[model samples]
Target: MALLETRDLTKEFGGLRALDRVNIAVERGELVSLIGPNGSGKSTLINTITGMLEPTAGDITYAGTDLVGMKPFEIAQLGVGRSFQTASIFPELTVSENVEVAAFAAEHDSFSVNFFRRRDAYDEVRERTDHILETIELDAKAEETAEALPYGDKRRLEVAIGLATGPDLMFMDEPTAGMSPGETEMTVSLIRELLEDWGMTIFLVEHDMDVIFDVSDRIFTLHEGQVIARGPPEEIRDDPAVREAYLGGEEA
Candidate 1:
C-alpha cells in the first residue's frame, strides 16, 4: 500500500470549491512534488491531508489508517509532520527550545505538566533535538533566539522542528520561499539529506522550477483545483497541458 493516499477528496469554502475530487497517492521513500500556479489548491490539499482543514468529501488514508476526522495533533502523532510555506517558529524562544518543544509534543502527545520541567529532564527529547539541529546545520546557533537568526536560518529551523517529530512522511510547503540563491541551495541540500540519508518520504508543494525538477521523483500539476498532469520530471517539463495551465502557454 502507498504511505499516503487520497481519493475523491474535495474541499469547499461556501460556494467556492478549492479542491474538486482530487486523488493522489504517495509511495514510501518517494519525493513527490505538487506544482501549479497560484490558487491551484496546492496548499488546500496539504492542509486537508494534514488535518488542518477537514475534507468536504472523500477519504484520506495514511499508512492504511483512515485520516478523515482526525485532529492535526492526532495526525502528527501518527508520524505525519509538516513545515509551512511561511516559517513557523517561536521567535522569542531559543532555537534549541523550539525543536525540543516539538520533540516533547511527539513523546507526550499533549503539553501537560511535563512541559514545565527542565529542558534536560527528558534525555530522549534532548538527544533527538540535538540530532535534528545537527542535521539541519543549526546546532551552532542552538542557543540563539529564533527571531534573531537570518531568514534562511529561520526556514531551516522550521525544517528542524518538523524533523524533531520523527515523521516517516513529511509535507514541506515551499520550504525555500523568500530565500536568496545561496539560501535556496542550502535548503535544497537539506531536503536531499532528509530523503536520501534519513530515508523519509516527502510530499512537497513548491514553486521553484529548478528545485522541483531537480529533486522530485514524480510531479503532479494542478490547475483550478484539479490535477492536470502527473509524470516524471522530464515529462512534466514538456507536458503541453502543464505549460498552458501553469505557465500560460510559455515554456516551463
Candidate 2:
C-alpha cells in the first residue's frame, strides 16, 4: 500500500473550493515534489493532509489509518512532521533548546509542568534532541541563539525541529524560499542526504524548478486546486499543460 494516500479530498473556504476532489498517493522512501502557479492549492493540500486545515470531504489514509479528522498533534504522533515556508523556531532559545522543545513535546505523554520537574528523568528526549542537532549538522551552533544563525542555518534548524518529532514522512513547504543560489544548492544536498541517509519520505512544495527536478522521484503538478499531472520529472517537464501553465513553455 502507498505510505500516504488521499481519495477525492476536498476543502472549501466558503464558496471557494481550495481543494477540489484531489487524489494523491505517496510511496514510502519517495521524494515527491508538488508544483503549480500561486493559488493552485499546493499548500492547501499540505495543510489539509497535516491537519492544519480540516478537509470538507474524502479520505486521507496514512499507514492504513484514516487521517481525515485527526488533530495536528495526533498527526505528528502518527509519525508525520511538517516544516513551514517561513522558518519556525524559537528565536530566543539556543539552537539545541529549540530542538529540545520539540523533542519534549513529541516524547512526553503530557504537557504539564510536572513533566519538567526532573530534567534527568527525560534522558531519552535529551539524547534524541542532541541526535537531531547532529543529524541536521547544527551541533556546532547548538549553544547559539536561533536568531543569531544565518538564514540558511535558520532554515536547517526548522528541519531539525521537525526531525525531533521522529517522523517517517515529512512535509516541507518551500524549504529553499528566498535563498541564494549557494544556499539553495546546499539545502538541496541536505534534502537528498535526508532521503538517502536518514531513510525518510518527503513531500515537498517548491518553486525552484532546478531543486525539484534534481531531487524529486516524481512530481505532481496542480492547477486550480486539482492535480493536472503526475509523473517522473522528465515526463512532467514535457507535459503540455504543465509546461504552459507553470513552466511557461521554457525549456528545462
Candidate 3:
C-alpha cells in the first residue's frame, strides 16, 4: 500500500473549488515534490490532508488508515508531521527548548497539561530533542535563543523541531524559500542526507525549480487547482504541459 494516498480528494469554498478531483499516491520511503504557481491548491491539499481544513470530498489514507476527520494532533500521533514554507520556530525560546516543547507533546500522553512541572522529567522528550538537534547539526546552538541564530540556521531549526515529533512521514513546505544560492544548496544536501541516513519519507512543496528537480524522486505539477503532470524527474523535465506552464513560460 502507498504510505499516503489521496483518492479524488477535493475542497471547496462557497462557489469555488480549491482542489478538484486530485488523486495522488506517495509510496513508503519516497521523496515527492508538489509544485505550482500561486493559488494552484498545493498548500490547500496539505491543509486538507493534515486536518488544518476539512475537505469537501474524497479520501485521505495514511498507512492504510482513513484520515478524513482526524484532528491535527491526532494525525501527528499517527506518525505524520509537517513544517511550513516559513520558519515557524519560537523566537524567544532557546533552540533546544523549542524542539523539546514539540517532542514532549508527542512523547507523552496527548492530554499533558502540567506546565508547572519540570520538563526534564520527560526523558523521551529531552532525548529526542538532543537527537534532532544533532541530526540538523544544531547541537552547538542548543543553548542559543532561536532569534539569535542566522537566518539559514533558524530555518533548519524549524525543521528540526518538526523532526523531534518522530514522524515517519515528513512534509516540508518550501524549506529553501528566500535563501541565497549557497544556502539553498546546503539545505538540499541536508534533505538528501535525511533521506539517506534516517529512512524518512518526505512530501515537499517547492518553488525553486532547480532544487525540486534535483531533490525529488517524483514531481507533481498543479495548475488551476488540478494536477497537470506527474513523473520521475527526467520525465517531468521533459513533459510538454509542465514545460509550457512553468519552464517554457515567457518569464521562465
Question: Which has the higher TM-score value, candidate number 1 or candidate number 2?
Answer: 1
User: lDDT (0-100) at residue 230 of candidate 3?
Assistant: 94
TM-score of each: 0.93, 0.92, 0.91
Poorly placed runs, candidate 1 (over 4 Å):
85-87, 110-121, 249-252
Query: Between which residue pairs do clashes occur in model 3?
Result: none
**lDDT by residue for model 2 (174-212), tens:** 999888998888789888888998899999999999899
List, residue by residue over 96-140, the lDDT tens digit for candidate 1. 999998787677775566755757558878888888998899999
Off by over 4 Å in 3: 85-88, 109-121, 247-252
Q: Which pairs of residues have clashing backbones in candidate 2? A: none
RMSD in Å for all candidates: 2.6, 2.8, 2.6
Q: Quantify all predictions' global Cα lDDT against the true fold.
A: 0.90, 0.88, 0.85
lDDT digits (tens) for residues 142-216 of candidate 3 = 999989989888888878877877889999988888878887887898788778888999999988889998989
Q: Positional deviation of 2 in candidate 2, in angstroms?
A: 0.5
Off-target runs (Cα >4 Å) in candidate 2 are: 85-87, 109-121, 247-252
